[model samples]
Target: MVGDEGRLVGGRYRLVALIGQGGMGRVWRGVDETLNRQVAVKEVLLPDGLPPGDRAQLVRRTLREAEVAAKLGHPGIITVHDVVRDADVPWIVMEYVSGPSLAGLVAQEGRLPWRRVAAIGAQMADALAHAHAAGVVHRDLKPDNVLVQDRRTIITDFGIARVLDGSAGTRLTRTGAVVGTPQFMPPEQIEGGDAAASGDLWSLGATLYAAVEGNVPFDAPSLMPLFHAILAKPLPPPRHAGELGPLLEELLAKDPGKRPTAAALAVRLTALHHPPTLRDPQPPAPPRQIHQRSTVTAPAQPPNAVHPPTRPAASARRRPSTSAAPGGPSRRTLLLAGATVAIGATGGWWAWKSDTKDDAIRAGTSLPGHTKNVYALAYSPNGKSLASASEDNTVRLWNVTAPDGDAEPAELTGLFWALAFSPDGRTLAGGGADGTIHLWNAADRRLVGTLKGHKEQVSSLAFSPDGKTLASGGLDASLRLWSPADRKLLARLDGHDSNVAAVAFGPDGKTLASGSWDNSVRLWSVAGRKSVARFSHANYVSSVAFGPDGGTLASGCWDNSVNLWSVTGREKTATLDGHTSVVRAVAFSPDGRTLASAAEDETVRLWDPVEQNGIAVLSDHSGALCSLAFSPDGKTLASADKAVRLWDLDRQLPAP
Candidate 1:
């Protein structure tokens, strides 16, 4: 029996409409008037097999699900809005996602194309990457747990997952509850070994195989046979997986160690070409080899005819003649003396060929700029001067030549973490750990004024393209929009539960993006003073930058990956993975041809943003690289570590 609509759930959430029913619970689409938002309310129906006391345990388990889901905040991960009890029934309020499940897609489309499959796989991988970074493991992963809208994918049903290092009381399974989907479970998972990130990878492979092949790799008419096949038989390669190439082999590897990491797989999948075919056939052997004897022999030719000389004979004939007097002219010497005759016979063939020097330059180099670990960097609209913010607490202005040459850098002081130049390169904004935003004349290294309002450390700062509004995020968990001219705070946007780490203005300046340690990135309307979208990540989002086209937003996270989201916030176009540690900063090259990421791994990586492949790694830094900036001319890149280093974009290799 279900409760009436007037009944209040969890003392807060108001039940509205029944949305779905599952084996373990009933779900309702409810409204959280307190938050002024819609949330999915799931009510667990206690199993009849459980005793009165055991029923309490079941309720406790349901509560734990909410606790676990709440910790995993990621765009690709379904958000858990709230958790509470309604009339003694445990309920969880999650972000309401109006999207079709992956199971529905399979039923409707039969099979998805490789590109879509790859795209989905990449998203899932990124979700897992964030979860793993936060020490969480999604024990159960399957098609039904994945949601798709506008062809964008998000992983849901984190009910059975557990946060790594989280308290044991939060674990839901009752010792032998059969936690994962049978078809998708990895061998180690079935054996009850602690599921690691690799288990999720294995499941991703199974899910991807089913999506592209229209059938599970291990399948049968009945459960027993399917179980046997999954445990015994090898998975069949996807028939329609044309140019998936190395990705196919990597995804299906039996040994988890042999499989590519999520970051590596994302890069490989990005290069996949559809409608691929098998390798080319071997060419036929020459006819002369078919008639040859077992023993090898040189072919014979007439003396007057042009013939290829045998190596041994030519060397022997060219050796100094012992028969000739010491230092006297031999047959070879006589041939050299008659070089003019030989040259005439050869028709001057050798004179036409000449060796040429290689002219192509490498990609990714540190450009001249700041003097310390750069915390912020951005290219001006016209892509001329590059501005950098550093731990040295100074903003540096750099002059870059159009083609490529020497770079001259000018410095200003303060331990700044973020820097942005006006669209017209007339003004510069620098934010620091001291909770102040300073404006500067871009043309000269003079301070214009300091804008102050934040009560804590300022982590990020951004300026509207119109240069009228500036947005800043800080440890106060608030976003402030400022009037640069009057140094007045226009609006204080507050919602995040933790420190706000990043902020950016959309191309039109109508929207602003702010990322925080709360593991959420919120999209706000500059005029309406309202949030338009909320994106979650499993870990703190460290940085966000809009692409040159303004159609996409790229976010870097402590998860060590970057995600590209469409403007509508309906889809994640790609997940770029390469950093081995927390990604502290991310920026696009002036032309958007390359994406530069600085990481705690002490390495700055340059990636092909569109292709999602890492093009180069700048490994000279011995400390964490906190920020990166590209010159307006697109020829130089400035990275910050203990000391700022300038990288020549045209130089691909590392410094000696």
Candidate 2:
């Protein structure tokens, strides 16, 4: 038993008020004298008859929880303040969050709006991303652990599941003892297997299902039956009361791999409520028909199709022949048989190709080519030329459209670090490590002039929609605007405290967005050359771009994530987390229907901007991929690493 007092057990923490009580422990809003802050102290009284070894294991589990939670820090995660021993009892001090749990909200309101569920789910996904990155998995993720307050959703008790990470000997119950709450345990977890990140995903699915439908998908009288049902039964889709049918079906898929991750699921939920807003009025291109051809070899057949003579009518059996024909069959018979075989093979090959001709795209078509990592890639507005720059100090221009349609790439080179093409498709501008900006004629591939003024290596380059001004940022922590025609520096804007990694001109060309290594993105007035607003981030910003409508700005960062923000800088619209390494670039499609992101993981991922799900991943690169671009026609996407790759969006897979 514990009491509210200045001293509890041995004066580890002064208890103020009881926050929550669970089956295993009591949480109190307390004051930690050493840390000088209010903290949530969780106290678990040891069972009176507990084995000595089990008590030791519990102590070990408590200590491990402290170690794990201390390493993780994210807005969506509850902070662990400290851990202390009070006589025989152990307690964990966590940041005191004054918020209502999702369970409390559901209990009070009965159900939540789909959009609010999506918003909360997205924040939980971000928290999971952080925990997973730190090699910690939350085995018990429930509505009770989700704190929602002040328009923010936070995931609490991040490391309490360390108890489940214990060795088999440390487990107190039998082999199939009940662990997680039965209603939310995935099929695999119910079979006495260890819980993994996938299990948490299933729990999230169950939680969301409950939130949307106001009931649990599976309910039973006891834990054992619930476990049996989870392991042996298929989850029924949510009741058809409204529009949650499709979303529930996807969430409860039997195979964890088939189920979408939280990040992907959030996007689907978003699309359900807020359909995509198309920027351009043009419709998508008509589907393309692909032609396929093949050649096959045929095996020769015997000229005589007659069956071998059987044993004489079960009476007199004839002996087998002692010797056969010299080459087993006559040459004329072989030639005739071969000709027949060839005819049959030709017919089959033709039929096969004709049947599957509509699908001809091959895997691994994209190839990487730079000596060092590729930093940027862009396709000309006409969609005939592709340009890429790399850390190896070289830029290569590949004729995207070959005259013969099958001709290999033709490379045009310069020592460049970033590349972008003008809106009119007449010129290509490249920023270089040599502190020079080179312009080239897009059609003839002729070098024009170098704009020289920057005193440090350029990191990013972008052109305005009208193609009047080019924005460049570099290691000198300054942004320079240049006039492409005259190759003259228009203005150098300086305010960033660290190197600028990315710069973009807004759709209206009135503002410029620049992201820097100092973990901030600043909106600047292009004409006035002054900062308007600064958006702070937890990690270094790697890339920045404006959405098609120019109302939202998207930034990719070293936090292994991407975020969308409103132009007014009021709130974050969404946070996308899937890349396993640093995200280097983010690009929205011309139609704004898709988003392309390149990361240090050596792959370019295609995301449905409205849906938020990653639809395709191009992974031919063997080195870090640093840039992404889409063709103006929206039929092709280009990704760059050491080499550049062009993916044909028009290509389709064959029907099974």
Candidate 3:
């Protein structure tokens, strides 16, 4: 249309030329008058042949969800500058890449060389790792989403699959609104699972399978047959996968649980692309320094990767043995923390310390069930039950009383980032991406009511000690108080400039402390709904929790470190660092004697909060660690990914 060319969108963006158009959306190379920069604008055009219903709302929300991609900062990933809706059409502003899409490149060049495929796959893995660590699942991972800018590979259009699926699993199959490409969709996805990050790894494998073999692992002329082939049929062996074949096969496993997690995929890809020739066990950081921050630079792997191997089994250089893990699970090198922080752990306790020491926690057993990433874990007040929430949009209610007993899956309307139990254990609260708090009857797991107020996904939730008032913080940067009794909003507390990632009620329930992406934790007076004080974090804070005594508060951050603050002093008492990845969840043991922390490193560390020294590192998970909770008796520490792990603290021994 003549009106489209040279048209202004969101006031300042002038669409100069159409770069491309597809079933998903249209890409336009445009100019930003305000920023004085050239930009690529993606006008998300809903595909044709859909049920005749209003999808405009879906577009807007999906665009907002894409904002979560802005948090993905890896160089291999395209930068999402802004997402806006103009005239009911959503436009995403991103860094303009001059290179062709992987799909375009592969189409024009037929089949890629094994080395080329390895190189591209490695970069793609790195990008995916970053997304996974940030808790953003690139629901759609395919050749078209990969952009090759010279030697650099970048992934784009994140949050699309998540936003597209909109509804809970399997229903997409009924509505024919499935999230990803047919050939690239994982079995879990075809069957109607929500945005499971493991499914992305599967898609990555298929994308690589197509890049080298010149065809996807599975295909059919129609959608039903294609899904059937994906489900019942096995992945055809690759003809040109070269050394990458084994990894590809692993990624395409029929079982999602059997796949390499977000962190492992990147490490495996990098290890294959750059095979270690040195006799040394440690693979010298790849010739390029870019692959160091993520687990072996895999891009900060997933939160529940069966094991974030920390290093390529064949890579060069050995990090100092976290004295605790000399013969145990591998731990990456520790980064120096900001200030007043220490790293490592020893006898018993959970805390991320920076120093390399003999103290470390031992590995624990995995409780299996969920097929996707677990984002939040919470123990019921009475401690008999545990709740784990995942992107799969289901919360697994584990019977902690038996610890080995079967779990009951509680269906959710949407994905929740945080879970909290009522003080009396009569109700369970789920904070979800849809920005609603779903309350369920504790015993039967039946939905009782939905509390709404936050503008974006609820990132964290907390119930007062008295169980009268509930506090919530979200990506909308809004902190809200609600009375579950009446399902009404009591007040909205506003101060944070970015996503409020965590909320916690003080021991007395008189104060609420919230952590945010703005790099600060604000303490508010619960009843007054007024900001009482502010504590600065070394980096974007992901979690905040109060000690049993309420005299101290712990804040976990993206900086791969944890800071404990003295509640009275409102100042940092100690900084602990040990994990190589972002610290996602921090919890206090029932007695508050042991402070536990989980990070992207896939290890849960115990810290002696009183001594401010390292206790022990618990290594058992695969991808990044998101949430941690302690059983009422403090004998068990719970963390989630695909399976919820219950660390038997009493049986746990210091690493050799």
- Which candidate's TM-score is highest? 3
Off by over 4 Å in 3: 1-365, 409-414, 651-656
Tens-place lDDT per residue, model 1, 1-656, is: 25656456767787888877765567788888788788888776654455666567667766876687689877788888777876676777788889888878999989888877887887777677556545567766878788898746888767544421122432324343434467887766555466677777788888888888887777677656766776677778679866553466566666767665554344235323121212236355333221111110111111312212212211111111011234542221112211111111111111111113221211222344344445666666676566666655556665443333234455577666677776667888887655778888877767889988865557788889788888988765678999888889899997875567788898789988888877778888889999888876767788888877877778887666667677774456666554556677888876787677887766676655555544445555556667777766666566666555555454332221
Model 2, TM vs. native: 0.49
- Which lDDT values do the candidates have, in the order given? 0.64, 0.65, 0.73
Candidate 2 clashes: the total is 5
> Candidate 1 lDDT (Cα, whole model)?
0.64
lDDT of 1 at 464: 92
Residue 101 in model 2: shift from native, Å?
A: 1.1
Model 2: per-residue Cα lDDT over 207-319, one tens digit each: 87787677887888987787667667788766632454655666667676666544334323432432122222544433322121111112122121222221222222222
Q: Which of 1 and 2 is ahead in TM-score?
A: 2
The candidate scoring highest on lDDT is 3
lDDT of 3 by residue, 1-656 (tens): 43699999999899999988766688999999899999999988665454435465576567777788877766778898888889877888998999999999989999898878888987787577557656788877889999998879998888876776653223354345454578888888777666587889899889989999998889888878888988998778898888788888999998988886644455345435532212225445433121112221101122324213232122222222122434443333443331121233232322222223322221244567777778888888787778888866677887755524457665554667788999999999998765789999989888999998865578789999999999998766688999999999999998986668899999898999999877899999987889989987656788998999999999887666777787887677776656666788899987887788887666777766776656665554556567788888877678875667765555332343
Per-prediction TM-score to the true structure, in the order listed? 0.44, 0.49, 0.53
Error of 1 at 50 (Å): 3.0
Instruction: Give candidate 2 regions above 4 Å deviation.
Output: 1-5, 9-12, 45-48, 164-177, 240-247, 262-382, 385-656
Judging by TM-score, tell me the better candidate of 1 and 3.
Answer: 3
